[model samples]
Target: MAKIDIRRPHSLSVADARSIVDRVAERMREKFGTDSQWSGDTLTFQRSGVKGAIAVVPGEVHVTAELGMLLSPLKGTIEDEIGRKLDEHFA
Candidate 1:
């Protein structure tokens, strides 16, 4: 398994950060059939080969995921896509 850990500092409020994360979750669900839910400030998401959480804090957003063996090889691509999304949303 491969792990993806991305942290980005943001100026948005917790609520706003959550909104962005929710949008991201929705896209993931629509595109990849992911299952996601919110537990306070964290949004946890999972699918067959991926599992992750987006945590919204006062000044930052942290994304962490574990990829199954089959998906491990594409880790860089996945991470880059995520970074692009984060840049679009928060940067």
Candidate 2:
């Protein structure tokens, strides 16, 4: 599996961070129609044979996504999309 991870620090409070994470996870679920679960500081989603996790820390957020197929061509697009969303939601 190919893994992609993104991490960044934000100025929002923990509650706000959690909210942002939830919102992002919801968006991903809606768009991809994936099987997902959120518990405490981590949200994980699996769809189209790909699995992803979004973890929120005290002042930082980390996203780890793994592709289960052999489509290496799509990895960059996936990483860019996740990074863009994180920037938009967290900034």
The numbered model that scores best in lDDT is 1
Give the TM-score (vs. native) of candidate 2. Answer: 0.88
TM-scores for every predicted model: 0.98, 0.88
What are the per-residue Cα lDDT tens digits for candidate 2 across 6-51?
8988888878898888777787678878888877878888888688
lDDT of each: 0.95, 0.82
Cα lDDT for residue 88, candidate 2:
87
Error of 2 at 7 (Å): 0.5
Task: Report clashes for each candidate as comma-separated counts.
Answer: 0, 0
**Candidate number of the best TM-score:** 1
Model 2 spans > 4 angstroms off: none
C-alpha lDDT of residue 21 in model 2: 81
lDDT over C-alpha atoms for residue 53 of model 2 = 84
Off by over 4 Å in 1: none
